[model samples]
Target chain A: MTDAPPPAPPGRHDRPLAPAGGAQAVSELPVVTTYPLAFTGQAGEYFRIWIVNTALSIVTLGLYLPWARVRQRQYFYGHTWLDGQNFEYTASPVALLRGYLIVGAFFLAYSVTANFDSTLWIAGLIAVLFFGLYPWLVMKSLRFVAASTTYRGLRFRHHGKAGGAYLAYGLANVAAGLTGGLALPWAWFMQRRYQVQNAAYGNAHATFRGDVGDFYVIGLTGLAVGIGGGVLLALPLIALFFLLGGANFPEAGGETFTPGLVAGLVGAYLALLALYAVAWQYVRAATLRSVLNRVEVGGVVRTGATFSPWRLVWIGVSNALVQALTLGLATPWAAVRRARYVVQGVQVRAIASLDDFAADAAPSESALGEAATELLDINLGF
Target chain B: MTLPAPDPLSLSGVFFDGRTSRDRAATLTVSAGEAQLRVDGGLETRWAVTQLRIDPPVPGVRRVLKFPDGSRFETADDASVTALEARTGRNRALGQVRRLETRWWTALGALALTLALAWGFVAYGIPALARGAAKATPRSVLATFDRETVQFLEDGGYLGSSRLSAARQAQLQTEFRRVTAWAGGGYPYRLLLRDGAPEDAPFQLGANAFALPNGTVVMTDQLVALARSDRELLGVLAHETGHVTHRHGLAGVYQGLGLTLLSVAVTGDLISAGTFAAAVPAALLRNGYSRAAETQADEGAGRYLMGTYGTTRPLRDILARLDREDRNADESSVRGGSRTEDLLQTHPGTAQRLRHLRDIEARGR
Candidate 1:
């Protein structure tokens, strides 16, 4: 594919000085190239891997969990591609087992303490300890995931510190709670900024510049529309209630409500729920687009995505419905569809040839935190 | 010099030097001992065929051939991949997996088999394992669990002081002990009474009577007041003993745990919206075994009650009355049926249980 001319940098570009010794310098014209990212993994292919892994895991009575995890990650990673080179997951099963052992110890201790004490104070202390350690765990888990992954032989790295993670997660969450949840948009922005800014492939660092104002604008607008739609939907019910007057109201602790009134209330509640989910899906899509469009690698390679929220909602709703109907047997196919839709919409623009980037000699990080989270069933989904 | 003769097995493809973003036309020729790559620019490379690693095809992806020294030959051409596969036999494991995945009949067969096996595992395997495990467990361990569970309930306001008088309580306990003696010391049973808190509270366990695996039976004050006679109370306690003996509660716990793990494996990510969607039904189905357990418990109660009263009439009467009371109380909160509540109910419909009791009475006669 022919490269598109890069958009002017506006204000962020810093031009380097030309050579003085008569050597011809490369042109400053930005070379914008969008690398196609594709998910080549198929449900049929993955199913074989899944069935085998599951059978073995069952046969081994969960001892094969580490190997199962590695194989699963490797299958997905090895099929996802950018610029014709697939990403790879390099974490060993042994490392994962070590992580599981550490986590299992903590779980055992907690259960024992809770069982023995059976007191409110001990329960509170356990919850407090979990929250206190959560930020550091998140940071370590991200680092572990990044360190295990590679693209074109170059390792990816996560550079955020635990302190920064605390500010992004713990402090931001507290602020959101204190401000009657008005700070949620700002909290989301900060968290995304922290995650994106710290990610790098070899030496090309990513930058996220999406303003918090954009987050609040979309978030508040979505909330307003949701509330408005719900109220509008309930107008008929409210009208019906008024028309029937107070005497027809259901008596407390009595099953005397008119069937019509009960059905109206239930229907309105279900509609309101559906409306909320649809609105949230839209807000999520718009926010994801805004965040992804602002990411730049090395101040030269920019990435973007186009997401139609309506399409996303349909996909989300249908996936849930189908999965439920099939008793979760359709899960692999649903995952494939979602991944394909999202990946196909992503675009990358770089100012120069991507070949000059060299592999970094970064050491692999421990998968202990990730394994712990996995075992605990705490899905960060990073 | 004239070009070397083209081997009949030579396959044309594109090669990536592993250092640039450029792709060059190349031909891979596998000879007697070596695999050689000849690029368009007269650049030639050779590797021992044994040292070459071939990656399998994924949908919409290039098949890669890796050299020992780290260069790569990537091609979208199916011919090149087949040529390599023909030289080195296809991976047996992957090939088998691929067959099950790609062939329509095989995929269908696999799906059917998987669903059948999963259902059997959930329905029977987990419960059987739990029965074995509960039997193997020491009584001391079960006692500890029971003690801790009761303490938690009391702390959580789920258990309260019984409004029943001490004299009346003693009368009920005396009957319960007598009945157990008849069954040859069936259980080391302890009975606790709970007052019904207000509805909608976390501990709104309305008129419920349940037995723990360790032989502790909790009788709600509402249930005791609802009983017409001491014979009715004896019938309920006898039923609870049946639960303890069968280890139904422990089996239910194991089944629930197994379902959770199985769903996790199916969904991969716990955060998926589908995870909760799928979990609710599976949990309900697992608890659906409660219907069977209730039947077993009822039959046990019937045998004892018939021996004492010469009829299962008292036990059946109490069950029918309690079922009516529960329906009225539940419907008072919201008129008509809730689909979720109907789906999630662990116990058999009270009508169904009463019918089974009638059947037992019929057979005994």
Candidate 2:
């Protein structure tokens, strides 16, 4: 292959090429073909790690999770490889810590402002602030990663966006929040624009597929499970009804209260529980799906991943329960679930022996090919 | 040689004229031991990456890859790639990555928190706020009263009117003082009048009485035409003094106007331009009298009546008569709703006020 990804092998079986100018003595390149990452570590190990780290983080109020996870990820990905390319895990302890502080500040501000009890004006103001700073954070994050490593001759570069550009997109999503599912388009638009506008590349341009299902699915699932669990959880309220109905409440005027009222209130509680579960499921599904589908790649172009909502929901609910009981300490469980689910439907097609860049699996030599081809092209194209 | 900052350091800038459209700005950094160049570009197209890779490339170490347009990035550790990316970090890969991840999550957290807050507010606070808002109609500034009231004086009196002109105000004040002084305090009379009313002798009212801030009084022409006796008229004049002394006139005006303004402002019920030209009327309506102001005016009138006549009996008699007449008129009339309150309620109405006066009189009697 003089330059460029060598055309697919004439036969179905093809392999990525070695760097041109050949492999120097300074570097003896591996010849073994790498496959996309697959779960090689025992699920229990991951669970243990996730449980321990997440619990500790939660106990610490999410203070050291990022750094802790960095180590954990490094350990996990360092051993795992797909298409000959291993997952690269890195984190700036200060950055992670600072970022958490910033995020926490944001959380506090948001809660307070929302609690202000004034509508329309406050919501609009905060939403604008929320979206305005979004691009800055996105760019900062990208730049940090870009400056962090060189993988297959690639590095993350800083990318910033126009003022309020992302905000407009986000507002579109908020507009979609109104419709039970009808507003999915707006939400998709919001995610798409933000992702596309924020993405950077050393190899290929990244874009968004913008599927409405991503939002609708999340909304419905979160609503369903969260609401459903809430309902079942509150099922004990029925006893309260019997207690009230079986007894009586005295009125201020010295009249006996109706038992039926107690029964009615019990019914209302059950109804509220139902609503809660439905809402929880809806949010869970949609949020996870949306996050999972957003992808950025530098080499070949592929759209995005799609997964069954049911699997995501189950994982989300169990993890969520742990998260709730432990006050989000079990978030890593959710992370694991999400990470696994995210990798589930993703497919990367690179040369068989060459690394598949798209797959989240353990093998990816495609980055090497790009660098080699880049060198060859500079000789000719430029 | 001093090398420039690593290639993948900058996210966006216009360079490399050929691929300007593609955002293919790439920077290279080669370390002493590890020869690597960090590549930052907008596109990682087949030709895009190929051109640079062939440049007798001093094999890359860890490379920080990024695109300007798309936030696409990767770090490759393929010995050569790692060598390249390492230039960007100079062996500090961990720091930058942590920063990046931190930034992303920080942003996510902010967005989530904000949304939650907005959602919570609209859900909980709005209903209560809406209820409060609904209570105050805040329409137009105007006087308001819970109930209509009226009082007729003791003597069978005629409600007299003052001339609307400025000069008439002076004349009426003089006339009242002369009559009462001559009557041996028989009729301690003073008129509390409104401004801008009819100047022709008997002032009339369609909606309300207009007693100005000054002692000069102007009864609505309606009031003037409503009565018969001159003695009764004297009583009416004295009654007007009661109002002036008590400053009930101001209270009446305030109730009629300032309260309405407050009500309108509170309820967001601004003045209706079509019905009343809000500008001047609003100005007129906004002034409210303090309770002390009303009491001061009442005392002034009371002292004049008591000091001059040396008796509160006449004032009491006047109040009782007015109360009966007011009740009869109010009940007997088929007048429109607006005419309902030709009242003397504010300055101790007929019953309690008379009783109070009689008591005061008893103390002196």
Candidate 3:
């Protein structure tokens, strides 16, 4: 309830600023203040909203999805606080409905065409068109999300060019594919750099100083650990199955499953799932730390994140188990728990006062791209 | 234009002018449906309460009021803001939504409704819809799918050239034609004999028979070898013919598509982990659908065998033999007997299926 800023941490003021790309020295700055972000959304409250939204979506046969999406976004954005002020989502539900309908129509057309023999070529054409326009759609989606988000009345912006998006997404994907996935790390680095460096708060553009080598280190290591650990963990369970005399090798294609075999298979599956969760969390945490920690906005506001990969893995794996056990009833709690951890880990350091950034003249963005990206399961959030 | 304010309700807040991130201490007073903002060491502004947009109140969060000029006021005085908002009478529906969101009983009721609705949709809605979709599908589409599936199977080495003798193939094909004719010739049926147990195939299909959507029946060479009598092979063919007649393959495709869409809609933004969790239910639902299709096909085959041979014993014998072979292949006396395992299985238990066939035969008699 207090409006006063938290006191600077001990010895933080005396610590010199590490020279970043285009960042000025600490001696030239007047003062520095660090504000940690906070998420105040409660699971209990969000559970209610989730239930209402889900029920209404079902009853309306998904017609109310736009409103549900807006409500959900508003709840999350309104509860996230930085420097005692919350973020705002200003997108209209009607705009989102237009986008949803457009995307829905496209999907229906594709599915219908795909099912018919003569019309199959139309489905192929649609796919080709979608792939060709993907970069533009991604750029528009970024701009839409940024233009809709507001903190302290100044909207965020994404000014990444369509050409740049193509280079980051289309070219990078081709390179990764050409290398048989060996260049995946480079692809991720390019995309992250594009996303981070093109982001702006009000009129202040952000910068990314992350290195590509760091991405390779994290990406390859995660893959190795995931696969190696999964095999190691599963071997014993499989061995146990054979040892227990449940080895139904299915000679001559007479397939059969015993209780022991089923148990062993399930155990092996869980082991692999756990290892995958660990690896994915590790990569996500490491990449987030690298990108966010190096981000500087307007050469005045610096951002940093500190996340433990193991903690993320625990949260993710446990959340999945809880969701599976409860048949998705505990989804709200899982989301809130993860969001709270991730959001609170972010720290914003500003050498200047937080009240100086000016707004830009932002053009209104249609939600078609946003809806398309969401349907494709693209994660644009930083 | 300033009139004397009556019954003015005042609260402390911060104001933002929208052009910049600047914030300042301010006092907001609401009276007679008009609101006034007095910024400390700044300008005074006023607006009609109806013209201002107040964000729906979240519990323990400050009320944010948006002005017509893109400026905003944030205040922690929820009570005073709620009092002011009551006069505007806007956002009444949203207010009700917020109320529903905040109450325990309403949320509980909503959860129950969601579960019940999901259950009903899965139980009855999806099957009915799939049946209708299957019926509406053009024959050309079904033929295309059937061709593509067969081509893919052959290309993938899941099916190989039959090693059976030309004489055996001819005899079986002739019998297959006769059976199709007797079954009303509803479709232009084709019988394909293939070696299904390819060494490098992902899964072994030693003795199997399946029907495509366009009445293409594939009988494996191993299945021909396993049959002790021609009547058994004919019975298996009758069962597959039933599948083609009911368009079960097309129905299955529609059902799978419907389930995927439903899961995606239900999971919404829980993309990463939620999708993985949805797979569990999806697999279970698919198994249920497959079991239903199997039962329908069994009934159809039973009727055909009884009408043609004056007994359902051929189909029943073959099915029971296949089940025993599967059980024996496990090298254990106990088969997949647990309830959970039964639920997950694509086919109904042999005992249950055999019992149904007996009941059908008795009714026919």
The global C-alpha lDDT for each of the candidates, from Candidate 1 onward, is 0.70, 0.41, 0.82
Model 2, range A77-98, lDDT digits (tens) per residue? 4434333333444445455565
Error of 1 at A168 (Å): 2.9
Which clashing pairs does model 3 show?
Answer: none
DockQ by candidate, in order: 0.20, 0.01, 0.36
Candidate 1 residue-wise lDDT, B13-130, digit = tens:
6576644445567888777658889999999988887888876543334456778765677655556565556556765544344344444566456566666677787778777776
Most accurate candidate by TM-score: 3
Better of 1 and 2 by DockQ: 1
lDDT of 3 by residue, B1-365 (tens): 14455468898888999999987889988878778889989699889877788887655456788899989998878777766766666668767777777788999999999999999999999999999999998888788988888988898889989999999999999999977886653677999999989889877788899999988999999888877788889989988888888889999999988887787776674244245567778888989999999999898888888888888777777776687764223112224456776688998877677778889989999
User: What ordering of candidates by TM-score runs from best to worst?
Assistant: 3, 1, 2
**Per-residue lDDT tens digits of candidate 3, residues A282-380?**
888778877888899999999988767668768988998898788788999999998888888888898887889999888898888898888767766
The residue ranges of model 2 lying beyond 4 angstroms of the native Cα positions read: A1-36, A41-66, A72-81, A99-135, A138-153, A156-160, A163-170, A173-184, A196-201, A211-299, A303-306, A323-334, A350-382, B1-365
Q: After superposing candidate 3 on the true structure, give the runs of residues whose Cα lies further than 4 Å from its correct spot.
A: A1-29, A108-120, A180-183, A220-266, B1-12, B57-60, B79-86, B150-186, B190-206, B220-234, B269-280, B306-310, B326-338
Give lDDT tens digits, candidate 2, residues B126-155. 323433432332222101111111112101
Give me the TM-scores of chain B across the candidates. 0.85, 0.32, 0.85
Q: What is the TM-score of chain A alone in each candidate?
A: 0.82, 0.54, 0.88
TM-score of each: 0.80, 0.36, 0.85
